[model samples]
Target chain A: MSELSHRLSISIPFENDKQASMARKTMAVDPVLKSNELLIKFNQEENKLICQFMGTSDRVIRVAISNVIDNVKTIIECFDEFDGKDDVQFEEKQETI
Target chain B: MTQDLVPTAHYESPSEPKGYDFIPGDGPHSTIGETTKISDIVINAGGQDRDTPSEAKDTALGQLRARLTTIQDKINIFLTNKMKEEKSSKELKDLEKKMLDEGVDEGSSDNE
Candidate 1:
């Protein structure tokens, strides 16, 4: 069995208590999910992604989380490309049988 | 009576007063006036470190091109490696599925 590989992780903040609860719920199931108040950026020179979040207000935390997720997705997309070779693609025939 | 306009010649003359004599100061050293050196000094300083302008520019351009080529090579290597990893993972997954289908796991009588 091929192991799933994760290349990066990040976090952001949420200020809305209600939204923060919802976000926590989502993150509970997804290990890759995280949030921070400040938008994290991928620094090519540093060769790492960075994000910083501060403050306890729930509403702001939710916004931070959204921003963090968007930024992470953008960074991943920058490195990702369309290739027709993957575990799922290879196992398709076996699964049919 | 028609006024005759004489054509003026455009000539540049020295702006400073002509034939101005610069007399040395008649101080206490005037008796032993400063002597001017008539001989030229042959400077044996080191050679110029830099190339001619054209040569320098060519060298800079060549270096820039080399750096660009290196970056391109790195990008190509990264893309090739990514493709290889994808292919390798795919093949491994297929092999795993095949083993499961062939009852390779069931024949293990370790429990029996």
Candidate 2:
């Protein structure tokens, strides 16, 4: 294709570079289900995780971008739940899932 | 509020890709299981690509509404296709069964 039919960029600011990098790496590990119709690239800018989405259609990019946002929300939610909870019993036990 | 946990996004695009540095994948086909041939959510993109929001139709809300409409239209088309496929498949099966029954009846007459 001469030009991508749809494109979007999202920036999420984390607490630090480590957090941003973590988010980027985690999202990077997951594969894009539709590579032809959609491609996502994750980068880090200081404390911000920058995500770029290029796709062939509005719906394809929309679905993919929303999914990434949902996953990032979960990662941040985990930070809220246990990031600073030192000496928490949850960390001591092995994670099953 | 506990913190500013909002994510910002934009639609600005750069020059066309050079067909290089394209990350390789499992080819240019969908890797998702249970995929549908009905693709490309047909949508008339509004003033979402405008550099500045000049009117009500160019605002952030307007862009969101446009995007949502794309999804809505896609959902409608997908459901319609599903219904059409189901109806055609059912009719084909019924026709096959009818032909089989007619063949059996004709065979009985020849047996005499």
Candidate 3:
């Protein structure tokens, strides 16, 4: 059996709530069977990941997360993504602490 | 941080809906007509300048009092709204965690 050990971290920056919400839905159906909602964190916070799932290898995790990101792009194509609101903010972030 | 710094030029005039006067919390909680109108800015014709030292001190004290009251009101509004948002965000986060955990458990079983 495969180790089933992996960690997938994805940071998607979008200008508004519509894009963020779309990103969440897209991640729910990742083809790699590791789809999970991207943690939507407020930009002000020091800790980016508001959620996480731990497993045994980074390769599997990366493939799963990449699938989610691709799905998010698909969602963006179908709908109006970000409006660039005055108060709205976005930041793509990832780092190993 | 530099990111938090808003361009001063962006606060030009009332032309921009998000002006310097714009409240930071969610949307305007003030009722229509409840706030002082810009058009109401007018110099009182009967108002006289304070010439004496005592009169100047009194005027200064009154101005300080008014400013303090305005600051207090803003702080109260901010704290109230912040508490509400915190409570709601916490509840939503908890729900998201439960759903995600269930999904992860199902995935583990699938691997089994």
Candidate 4:
């Protein structure tokens, strides 16, 4: 419960609301570690993904922020590699079995 | 000849330069030793005048804003490419499916 010394907030804009929502959902699934030393919150506002971090030190804040950014990168990679149509086709194929 | 080869008893010691020898408007006259400051590598998120706790927080906020903007730019580019690829591939798959269905119908009609 020491006073959080550092705070960082970031808003990443997406092309549309859907992509922002996807990013928010993906990030929400992963819980932040060291909740006492750091806090991470993510929200989707229109076409922007808003991220906030509060930590006791610069290192903790930076580490939390970077970890989220890494996850965002992975989400972007998945979107690039696969589309909703492919997922639908996959599901349909599985249903036939 | 032997005296000329002999070391002098009053050998002059190398003297240190009084100050940096560089012309005011010209390039460096000699190489300056490499030096690094913490401020050079570590961002003083709170500027040099971080006297109070609030001031330090403000500096950290400023740094966060700057970093976020950079991250935003990167994510924007990646998302754009992702969307473009998704659209193109979906179109291609739709076209292939349509062609396959048409060929199946033609084969059935010819068998009649």
True contacts kept of each: 0.00, 0.35, 0.00, 0.00
Q: Please say which candidate is ahead in lDDT: 2 or 4.
A: 2
For all candidates, state DockQ relative to the true structure. Answer: 0.01, 0.15, 0.01, 0.01
Q: How high is the lDDT of residue A60 in model 4? A: 67
Candidate 1 segments whose C-alpha is farther than 4 A from its true place: A1-97, B1-59, B104-112
Colliding residue pairs in candidate 2: none
Descending-lDDT candidate ranking: 2, 4, 3, 1
- Writing each residue's lDDT as its tens digit, candidate 4 over B1-112 gives 1111000001010121131111112212111111111253444564452321111112222222233334433333433454466578779999999999999999999999
Docking class of 3: incorrect
Candidate 3 residue-wise lDDT, A23-54, digit = tens? 45555443334334222221211211111333
User: For each candidate, what TM-score against the reference?
Assistant: 0.23, 0.47, 0.26, 0.43
Model 2 agreement with the true structure over B2-95: per-residue lDDT tens digits: 3333345655333323321211122222112122222334224332332221221332222322332333233334434544665787799999
Q: Pick the candidate with the highest lDDT.
A: 2
| Candidate 1 CAPRI assessment class | incorrect
What is the per-residue lDDT of model 3 for residues B1-112, given as tens digits with 9 covering 90 to 100? 1111110011111222343231223322221111222223332554433321111112222222223223223433433454466578779999999999999999999999
| Residue lDDT tens for model 1, A1-97 | 2211211123222222333344344434432323432222222112222233332232332344334443333322222222223535444454654
Can you write out model 1's per-residue Cα lDDT over B12-112, one digit (the tens) per residue?
11221131111112211111101111112321353442411111112222222222223223323433454466578779999989988767556765556
Q: Model 4 residue A83 lDDT?
A: 35
Query: In angstroms, how far off is A61's CA in candidate 4?
Result: 0.7
* TM-score quality measure for candidate 3: 0.26
Q: What is the lDDT of residue A84 in candidate 1?
A: 24
Q: What CAPRI grade goes to candidate 4?
A: incorrect
